[model samples]
Target: MTTDALIPHATGRADDPQVRRRAARVAGIGYLAIFVLAIFANFVVRGSLVHPGDAVATAADVAASESLFRAGLAAFVVVFLVDVPIAWALYVLFRPAGRDRSLLAAWFRIVYTLMLGVAAVFMFLGLQLVTGGPGSGTMGPEAGMLMFEAFDYAWLVGLVAFGVHLVLLGRLITASGLAPTWLGWALVVAGVAYGLDTMAVTLLPDYAAIADVMLLVVALPSVVAELSFTAWLLVTGWRRPRVAAETA
Candidate 1:
């Protein structure tokens, strides 16, 4: 009897190489959406709307640009929504490497998403606090500033979970031999950067003094890691040929 006849294949249909390739491509697109929308919302819109340590000014800025503030909130909502499928797609694409580890990574990302979603409520509340509507007069500029700061700190907390996900994902990708080893190393670096930055912000008394320098140090590796991985998924889908796995 042939070995094929004697030993049945254990892989499921979702485990098919073609399916994984398609999933990888979708995940890549999702990553691009996340990167672009997050940058726009967090940096561009928030930067324009907020003035550090000046609650009255920040509130005035947001109130003056109400439509823009709403748009930024919407962008964050979209990011939270996209994150759900990205988690599942990544789990599907990487599960072949180590199912348990992949699942753990996915859960970490999901937790981060949930935390961000909760944080977004603070953004919406900030809008209400700054708007010229009922209850707006009751709350002062300080209240609005507190809401915005809550949103920022909440996101920073979420980053901790996100960092864990990246570390697990980086390890998986490096071991899989399906992606460039350099990309995996970059991801590890990014993960470490995230953790360190979070610690600085949360635990350090001199966080403000060093914040800009820390951001500069963390930015490059994190951007390169994510963008490179994203481009690889979009362009190559997967490095390994489907035939090899199919025949095996």
Candidate 2:
């Protein structure tokens, strides 16, 4: 009997472990690029300080807000467009073909990533409208508030899906022995943390900003773990593609 017929079709490719590992390494780089872009983009998206107590004062404030909002919108588009493809590519790398399960996972990742992009766009629009003061254009304060709410709702879904994907990925990585156990655990933990944070923010208004901060904390270790995994994958190239029995 052929080994191919005996083993389940996990990878979508022609069982080329080398190609998959290369894809994983490239996906890691894409993740790194995303991290860099997000961090750098923050500076441009900050917008002139909207003094707490003071009323909407000057045109410059409005101009700064508009500029920041537009930058945020543009970033959202880029992030979404880039992320969907990245997720699909990565999914292709790691999927275990059991009917359409792999396809479903890939689709969820794409949906969640796209949703996140939509959320970002909504937030940017809301911020821009609010910055325009009370009666700027068609949207008013109420509309801005609604936009924020929509953004938050959409983000909740994205985070949940993303968390699930990460947890599954961690399990896959561990089973494959592509990286250290600690790295696998880190992915699982980061995924859970983000998932929980998303839930918390949705239910508790007081913890909204706190949730965002928590995600950053979770991400720090997660990124480091990922970088380590990338290094190993690039260097070793999954030399011993761990057998199912071995993982067991």
Candidate 3:
């Protein structure tokens, strides 16, 4: 990284229209790809396989669909690969609003992404058990479930950081006045929902009983705000809005 890149410069460096536009485009595309792949891996692939409290079933599912499980893991790898560039793109896109805040937001997301990488490693552990690989004798269905749970909880912890990133991202959007203010607010609300849901899941032993409702609470806002923000990046972020408020 260049020295100029290391030190957070003032807003003027990022105020260039073309630069912001390019950053927006890059982030938009990367975000779209990661979102789609993640959803597919979690819902279509793992979702179908993993039973909340049933270890034998989960292990059997993974074994029956070993190839799909591998594909799902590959999908995660793709998301992580795309995540680094998205972090940099987001930083560039928002630094004009507030350099310090943008830098912090990017760091939060990078940290979260690394946590996701850890979750993927756990998924690999589960795969090893299913394939009769090393440690298979020592590991069984119960242990496989434990690995999967580890993946989920690790990723859940990561979401807290991701939530913070989203909140800061929302503030940047609103501060810059580069996109619709409502969208920014939506992002903020979504961030809070993410944190709250994570907290509940962590603290409440019977969270599963109300998982559906909480999922709605988090998923509704998350989908709406993030997808809308992605849409904005694609359609409107690069260009200056009719009224933009820049910080000094």
Tens-place lDDT per residue, model 3, 1-248, is: 45444323234467766667767777888889998999989999999988878988888899999999999999998998889888988898788788899999999999899999999999999888766778789778888888899999999999999999999989888888877999999999999998999999999999989999999999999999999989988884445654564531
C-alpha RMSD for every candidate: 6.6, 7.7, 5.1
Query: Candidate 2, residues 1-248: lDDT per residue as tens digits?
Result: 46343222344463466556555655655566666665545444533423222334323453555766566667766777767656755665665433244456567667788788888877766676676654458755555666656776797789788777777767766776645777778777877876877777768877845856776866776667656655554454334566744896
Model 3 worst lDDT window (10 residues)? 3-12
| Tens digits of per-residue lDDT for model 1, 8-87 | 23354546776677667668878999999999998989988988799989989998899888999999999999998788
Residue 62, candidate 3: Cα error in Å is: 0.7
The C-alpha local distance difference test score for the whole of candidate 2 amounts to: 0.62
- List TM-score per model, in order: 0.89, 0.69, 0.90
Q: Positional deviation of 8 in candidate 3, in angstroms?
A: 16
The regions of model 1 sitting more than 4 angstroms off are: 1-15, 238-248
Query: Model 1 lDDT vs. the true structure?
Result: 0.84
Worst ten-residue run, lDDT, model 2?
A: 49-58
Off by over 4 Å in 2: 1-14, 42-62, 96-105, 131-142, 145-149, 208-217, 226-248
Model 1: clashing residue pairs? Answer: none
Clashing pairs in 2: none
lDDT at residue 243 of model 2 (Cα atoms): 77
How many clashing pairs does model 1 include? Answer: 0
Worst 10 residues of 1 by lDDT: 3-12
lDDT by candidate, in order shown: 0.84, 0.62, 0.86
